[model samples]
Target: MSIQLRPTRPADIPFVYETEHAAENRPFLLPWTEERHRQALAHPDIRHLIVEETETGRAVGYVIIAGLTNPHGSIELMRITISAKGKGYGRQVLRQVKRWAFEEQQAHRLWLDVKEANQRALNLYLSEGFVIEGKLRECLKTGERYESLLILSMLSSEYRD
Candidate 1:
């Protein structure tokens, strides 16, 4: 199945919200409000994109690049969600977004913090060239317990190849 990543349109706001609100995704993303999304569309440094299935024309996920700044170039994945986890959309979207960040944004580095238990996502990031730079113990509370956070990063020079 073909897939594409395009600049998110205003009409995509609701679908983005729904996809992020799905059961399997809720815990992985920060909670957002309608006003937040509206503001996001206007945010200068944030690049938000929507993922669409080409054959069925369905909205499946979104990728958000936030915390952009010059010189000290850095980016954090504000959000990423896929309707289904193991269907390969996550990797496709991640690679595309990383390429855009490396080429268009000229980012010096891209970084993300994943819950220690999110092995699936950690594996994807590692396979895509992000290295485990550090770990923070009990950094975030997932439920009744605390979860360690793993900091993963990939440099622009590394991605250039």
Candidate 2:
């Protein structure tokens, strides 16, 4: 069960887009267009990576990290999408992202906002040592309704490794 993250290539965009719009993943994330992904890929501040199963060389998921080019020590875990669930892929991806942020990137803080109703994601973030900083009420509008988001963060000092 070896997993690795690699730079996302242009050919991987469609798979990433499909995973982003998958029924199981859509509810937890904001709507996005293919152009947005392309922009991220081109942006100096963003890193778009594809998560692969090392044994099979299959892409299991993808992640988008932002604010890396900023002088500030804070970075955002902009997006992470796992095509398959219930197999610990999210946990593994998150652990790798944290290590990259705190260790490799020398970031002092890593943060993200999750929809409050996304219990599974909230649980994963909490279990990974991300602390809830606060809640933003009615922050997003999906269709005709508004939703709240919970802000979670992990500081470099709080990182285990």
Candidate 3:
């Protein structure tokens, strides 16, 4: 099946909330509240894109690009979920999002932080052209223990799309 990404609409909230609230997604969230999601969905600098399954037109994934103004623009990928992980869809969605950010948003650089233990995500980011910039030691408290954070980035010129 093919996938198409487009600007997210208010009507897409339920899908967004459902995908984000899944138990399996708890580890990746940034302790976001409902109000945060509301505000982010409406924010101008925050580019929110929804990946739609072409045949059904249902949102299968979403990505939020935040902090878009500076020349060294850093976009925190607020969230990205594909119902099922380990599939190739996540990579495709990320590439499409990066293309949109570079070609449409005119971003100079893109950056994101991943937990050190999230090897899958780290691998995805690296394979997608993001290089490790630094590691923030014990930056996030997942539960009772704090986890190290890996900072990754890519320049506009480095992006193929």
lDDT scores in order: 0.82, 0.92, 0.77
Q: Best TM-score goes to which candidate? A: 2
Each prediction's TM-score versus the true structure = 0.89, 0.96, 0.87
Residue by residue across 51-70, what tens digits does model 2's lDDT show? 99989989999999998977
Stretches of candidate 2 off by over 4 Å are none
**Model 2 RMSD to the real structure?**
1.1
Q: Which ten residues in a row have the lowest lDDT in candidate 1?
A: 69-78
Q: Taking the tens digit of each residue's C-alpha lDDT, what string does model 1 give over 48-158?
A: 888888788788888887877545888787667788667899998888878877898888889988888878888899999999999999877767988788898999989
Q: What lDDT is reached at residue 14 by model 2?
A: 92
- State candidate 1's TM-score: 0.89
Count backbone overlaps in model 1: 0
lDDT tens digits, residues 1-161, model 3? 66888887877767777777888776766646656667877787787778887788867877877877655655566557776565577888888778877888777777888888878888899889899999999988767998898888888889854
Where does candidate 2 clash, by residue pair?
none
Q: What's every prediction's RMSD, in angstroms? A: 1.8, 1.1, 2.1
